[model samples]
Target: MKKRVEHGLERFIFSSRWLMAPFYVGLIGALVLLLVKFVQELLHIAPNILSLKDSEVILAVLTLVDLSLAGNL
Candidate 1:
């Protein structure tokens, strides 16, 4: 009887780990949103590249680099 109870408890603990699935799914959704924003930013910058000031261009480049670093993390 003690061994059976122990086995059940172990199984319960293992199954409970799956409760984190939703959190992972949410993170993946966030990543997809980030990618979409990144692409949108690129499109926004491409059209006005010639007219942008040097500081504005630097800021845009840094924003892209920051997003890339975030995706890697």
Candidate 2:
């Protein structure tokens, strides 16, 4: 009986891997987009950091962080 239960559990885990495959692929794509956006933000800031108001800079930074978190999820 114990052996049967173990065998069932093993099969269940193997099948579940297929369900998670898409999730892994989506996470990788999101991570790549996040990296691209991060670089874009840096470029935008480099020219205006001194001229832009502090609040504007803060807002852009917050947006970058939000994108990173969403990608991680």
Candidate 3:
């Protein structure tokens, strides 16, 4: 009886791994989307950099950094 319970518990724990598969896939997707946004933002800001104030450039970089950190989390 004890061995049977152990085997059942082991199986249950093993199967639980599948529950996190979707979460990992979602994170990957989020990272990809964030990357695309970062690139787009860079392209949009590149030509305007000379005219942009220091604060404007800082805000744009910070936005990109925030998105990347969120995707990592």
Candidate 3, residues 1-73, lDDT tens digits: the string is 9999999999999999999999999888888999999899889989999899999999998987887787778
lDDT of 1 at 20: 100
Question: lDDT per residue, candidate 2, 1-73, as tens digits?
Answer: 9999999999999988899889988888878888898889889888988888999989988888887787767
Ranking by lDDT: 1, 3, 2
- What are the Cα lDDT values of the candidates? 0.94, 0.87, 0.91
Give the poorly placed runs of model 2, Cα more than 4 Å off.
none
Q: Write the per-residue lDDT of candidate 1 for residues 1-73, one digit (tens) a residue.
A: 9999999999999999999999989889988988998999999999999999999999999999988888877
- Candidate 2 vs. true structure, TM-score: 0.72
For candidate 3, list the clashing residue pairs, or say none.
none
Which parts of model 3 are misplaced by more than 4 Å?
A: none
Candidate 1 steric clashes = 0
Error of 2 at 8 (Å): 4.0
Clash number for candidate 2: 0
What's the ranking of the predictions by TM-score, best on top? Answer: 3, 1, 2
**lDDT pick, better of 1 and 2:** 1
